[model samples]
Target: MIPNAIAVDSATGAPIVLAQAEHGAESHGAEHMASTPGEHGGAFPPFDSSTYASQLIWLAITFGALYFIVAKIALPRLANIVEGRAERIESDLAEAKRLRAESKAAEDAFLKAQADARAKASAIATEAREAVARQSDENRRRLDTEMAAKLAAAETQIAATKQAAMGNVRGIAADAAAAIVERLSGATPATAEIEQAVDATLAR
Candidate 1:
């Protein structure tokens, strides 16, 4: 800015005024060139040096918000849901185990009851068969006793009938012989002698 003169205050010979004015003009020109570069000269917005601090600040805010949401709202809720599901699954598994144990007990009881029933039935059947056998034996013994008594009575009655028939036949024969002797020889036989003769002939 100073061309060919050494400028100074006329009285005190100070050099402050023109130097300050030249320095201010130079700083203004540099500021203008820095603010308005030519086309295709400065970097893209994202890579620009002037905006790096603002971009980093906004990035930090976004990351902090995401972290806060995950820590405070999203993660706690998800953890609660997962824990509830796990607890429910554990309770359900315990219930299932209990049910399985109960089922086993019930099945054992049922089997025992079935065995008892079968044993009872077998005992009943055995008793029934024994009773039937006893009844059949008693009936057979009773029939045999009746048949023996009837046979003895019938034999006794046939012997009595034969004795009476023989007595009647001997009398009739003695009478017939006496009649025949009277008609043929004019004589009657003695009763004692005729009886003795009939007995001897029957014996032979």
Candidate 2:
């Protein structure tokens, strides 16, 4: 606030004294704000414009140290890990290829064995069939020969029996005729004459 230029009493002496006192109070407040900056708001030491060059120099040193550690140490370890993984993958692929080839060869061998077994079985079956056929034919021929011999023997026996029966019938007929002649004429006929008559009748 501005001090009153005119006093209440309208005297010049009181007005001059008031103005001097106000001036002195304002000068004292200005001195107190300049000496103790912390008492009010002010710039920190690091952010102060007078210390800018020193802050920049320290920032450059820290950045250089971090860059060197990443480039020389961390990067080499990461490269070795990548190369190890790549070599392992290549070896695994080669082993898998070799196993596949062996599996194919085994399958081929199994198929060939099956084919050979089938051919051998077929040949054995054919040979068995031919042998059976030959045995059957031999049996049939033997039976036929046995039946022919039996039939011929039976026919010869029948012919001999028939001849003997005929001879008996002729003799009986001759005796019956001789007896009939004796009964009619009251005298016996001669045996030779009776035999001749019987023979002539039997011939007709």
The number of the candidate with the highest TM-score is: 1
What is the TM-score of each predicted model, taking all chains together?
0.40, 0.35
User: Candidate 2 at 35: error in angstroms?
Assistant: 7.8
Which run of 10 residues does model 1 get worst, by summed lDDT? 1-10
For candidate 1, lDDT tens digit of each residue in 109-141? 999999999999999999999999999999999
Candidate 1, 90: how far from true, in Å?
3.2
CA lDDT, every prediction? 0.74, 0.72
1-204: candidate 2 lDDT, tens digit per residue: 113323322444555345434543665444444433222123354555534665678777987887888788877888788987898898899899999999999999999999999999999999999999999989998998898889888888888887788778877877888889988997899988988898898889
Could you list the CA RMSD of all candidates, in the order they appear? 15.9, 17.8
For residue 131, model 1's alpha carbon misses the true position, in angstroms, by 9.6
The list of candidate 1 runs beyond 4 A from truth reads: 1-42, 123-204
Clashing pairs in 1: none
